[model samples]
Target: RDRIKTSINISGVLFHFVDTAGIRETNDAIEKIGIERSKQEISNADIVLQILDVTSLNDEDHKKLDDLLHTIKKEDVPVIRVFNKSDLLDSSQHSISIVSRETVISTSAVTGAGLQELKNALIKLSGVTDNYSVYSARERHLNLLKAASLHLNQASDFIKSNNPQLELFAEELRESSDNLGEIIGKTTSDDLLGKIFSGFCIGK
Candidate 1:
């Protein structure tokens, strides 16, 4: 399939981009493949960009729009609805009702209109705030958390028993504290530290 190529790079993270063929009414194999691939991509994506044609978001495209929303919502991924080709709409004469309370940006891809606003909207939707400090969290930390959670559950069960073992509960509490400490680098292993620092840029 000779489809258009699209790529996106965020800071230093590279992501694969998939561009699907435009929706068509025909029952051709190519169109079917395109639809299937598009669905797959939407399901796997961390975020869904539901692009709407600003000039055609009426009854004609309502069913398709509803279907797209339904498909994306199945995976519980956050969606940023884009009203593209907004320049074609007469803002002074006509008004479109956006169902969502969140700001829906009007974009004209051809003229770079609203691109910055779109980017900002996407960044905000991603839930990464500027005030947050970046830190590397490894699988080890997740494992420790899981283990601690399990121990805590066990401790709770023991406390509910008629003959509770106080020493065992105390040991479990200590283990949970140790696990939490590792997450904040208070009790991290040398190997973990080496792996984390090795992945960092040389200048850092």
Candidate 2:
């Protein structure tokens, strides 16, 4: 009951994958925590892959899948239903009835069948092109951007006020600059400090 993260580059676009714990009834505290994290990851995902056992799907599974589909739809994330262990099924059982609008793929880990189809489907849905460049980011980057935005907003408010505190305004600007600098590895503090000192006219 844990998450295993890895990345793959397909068609020049990098995709981050987080394989989470399988959802099931559990009374164990650690397992419950893992299940909650899985739900959170699903909500935050750009695209989701729901794995199902091809050999054991039943009416109860279908009902649970329907509920999961409804929840995922609310997040507006596209999902791919992967029926794994296809090798266990007979050739006549390869075909499955359509359950939803989401793309469905049957794959066999043993014989490595349908893996290519899955990759092609991912490439298509991701809108990757020959000219595409891979760029990957994480949650920390998003949080930094949000912090920079807030500092900038505060600086803007200071500028629009009647009795604008120029010093406070400058401090907000510096704070915003520092936040952005964390992302790009450069800061304007030295330049800004020089400008502030030049304005002081200490010799006069």
Candidate 3:
């Protein structure tokens, strides 16, 4: 369980969080393999959360974080610097000097401090917009909007042609309108309406 990964979904986004053993001098062969595997995972990670123990602050800790940062390019992936075990240390000592105070998040696993802020940070790191439904729509609703946009683009092309296909343009406009209507619960099909309502868990 120590080297395994745990996946959790937030607002339709899946996050694979890995728990790796501390990077320390180990002569044990099995531990060495696990450490290498952990490195591989870090290399492939979309976002990294480096948790620093406040009480165990030392030059070695800083060096390890620096090495890790070098491995993961900051321009490609954002790194979240978390100072953990804040409850065990003073407020003054809870800060990380290398990173700006605004970028660093102070958290206490035992006391659940700064957890909500951490969640918001995780959602942001996952590349999701501010909220799941910015317009009070679900993931399906967003897909419909995308479809509608595509149809409108096709309609525009039809209208711009030298010998404009007025019929095709009208058809594309109709499809775009239908997709938008579906997003707003104006679907014509009873089966689609049933599926949409059931997805919201209205009666089931």
Tell me the whole-model lDDT of each prediction, alpha carbons only: 0.63, 0.77, 0.70
Total clashing pairs for each candidate: 0, 0, 0
Model 2: lDDT of residue 190: 67
What is the lDDT, from 0 to 100, of the residue 184 in candidate 1?
Answer: 54
Highest lDDT scorer: 2
- Poorest lDDT segment (10 consecutive residues) of candidate 2: 130-139
**CA shift of 130, model 1, Å:** 1.3
TM-score of 3: 0.56
CA RMSD per model (angstroms)? 13.6, 10.9, 11.5
lDDT of each residue in 66-117, candidate 3, tens digit only: 5765765533556677778889986677656664322468889999997778
Q: Model 2 reaches what TM-score against the true structure?
A: 0.60
Off by over 4 Å in 3: 69-75, 91-96, 100-102, 131-204
Query: After superposing candidate 1, which stretches have Cα over 4 Å from the reference?
Result: 1-5, 10-16, 22-25, 59-65, 68-75, 101-103, 133-204
TM-score versus the correct structure, for each prediction = 0.53, 0.60, 0.56
Supply the global lDDT for candidate 3: 0.70
Write candidate 1's Cα lDDT for 49-151 as tens digits.
6677887776545456456757567535566667898778676724567676335677888888888887776667656566643232346756888887987
The global Cα lDDT (0 to 1) of model 2 is: 0.77
